[model samples]
Target: MMKSILFFLIFSVSAALSAQTLTLTEQQINQHLTTQLGRDFPINLGSWLKAGVRLADIQVALGRQEADKARVSGRAVVILEQGGVRRDWDISGDFSARPRFNSEEGALYLDEFELLGYRLNNQDASGQANFIMPLLLQSLAEYLAQNPVYRLDEQDPLQRQLKESVLGLSISPGQLTLQGLE
Candidate 1:
């Protein structure tokens, strides 16, 4: 018994030591997704925008959409910058679907952004409060992979991970408009 306990203790310590930890709040995760994606997007929408993307608006829309099928109410300005000049590329309206199950209670949902018209690469929505992170991450990852800043064959580490993560998701293609920005 003593040997078994000792073995378990040592195994637990070694496992803990070998683990890499990342603790991120919802806001932080969203912000990271935005920044990482913004760095590699085909267009400099945020830089062109007068105020860039608002975290609060995205969060609220995501939360509301996840919780209930409320009208998505947020706008993203896509700014175009060339030769030191800046212009709006377009405005974006976010959309999400009201979860059938009580996602907020304990259900898990995945790729739940029906408003964008494309399904997330991951189609599992089985838990409450479970779909938003993957949706945001996958969206950013998809954008980055599809749009390369310098047209390089290889992307940055974060971009690669994001892209790989996207492949694992259950996403369907969605469309965004750039006409309104100009």
Candidate 2:
């Protein structure tokens, strides 16, 4: 009886220690981003541009690059008002950024964003598109900086424990894994 109890205790402790890592799937991350971004759509471009933009159909790819980075692509509608006339342009763009973990906040954030490419509905407006891209990127960067791409649920006992420790973040083919740092 004594031997059986000792073995059981050891087994339970080992199991708990091994389960310290949290993994997030690509679909899960995309869903979270879409919901969070949806709240702040039709972002204004400030007085200097006389324009605004809205993003939709956001998608994310993890571990797509040679380095530790994430790729995000989405469709944007740029609304420009000139002489009281409103014109809307459709644009699609891809962006890449490094993923970082904020232990204090128990969240994952994307940092150091880079625009991979952008396409405009009218090729003739390529020059104008170049000018508008920076503004759109700025808006996105600001939003991401303030918002987390994924957050650990403190309600779960394991996740709550994870929130208190430093974690090492890694990207696999289609998932983000956070492992507790010793």
Candidate 3:
């Protein structure tokens, strides 16, 4: 009887330890981004810009670079009003991104964007896009670095959720895997 009890305990512990990983699929990730893009975020460009940035289209490629990085292609339009004259600056660009994990907040933010190409009003604005599209995207790498996109808990109104969370991340082309810490 004693031997049987000991074996059962050992088996249960090992199983629990190995089953601590979490994974998110590529489709799931894109769905989340799409939902977010649909929402209009009001941005004040101060003197340089005067309008809202509308994210028209966005596509994310995971595992395109390394296991922990991603590539994104997106399009946005900035309504720039200069001297009471408004112009539609349609921009299309692609960049590489990576996630910054925060254990304290139990969230991950997509950051480190490298602008590969940018076009404004049908003109290539790689060199001048910085000054033109100031309201829309001026170095999104810096902006997203401070924003958290994924949250592991806080689903309910006021509840303390998931005690043990993902400690490490392994991102692949089609999926993101979370590994337990310790």
- Over the stretch 53-134, how does candidate 2's per-residue lDDT look in tens digits? 6665678899977458899888767777756867677778788888888989998888887888877866556466677667
Go through the candidates in order and give the clash count of each.
Answer: 23, 0, 2
Native-referenced Cα lDDT, model 1: 0.32
Shift in Å, residue 157, candidate 2: 2.1
lDDT-better candidate, 1 vs 2 = 2
TM-score of each: 0.26, 0.77, 0.71
Off by over 4 Å in 1: 1-24, 37-40, 43-63, 68-87, 97-112, 116-182
**Predicted structure 2: lDDT:** 0.76
For each candidate in the order shown, give its overall lDDT on alpha carbons. 0.32, 0.76, 0.65
For 117-177, candidate 1 gives per-residue lDDT tens digits of: 3222224323321433333434532342342212111344433233222211111122110
Best by lDDT: 2
- lDDT per residue (tens digit) for residues 92-173 in model 3: 7777788766767876678877676666655643544476554356534455567665666566422123324555678877
Give the per-residue Cα lDDT of candidate 3 at 165: 50
Off by over 4 Å in 2: 1-19, 41-46, 122-127
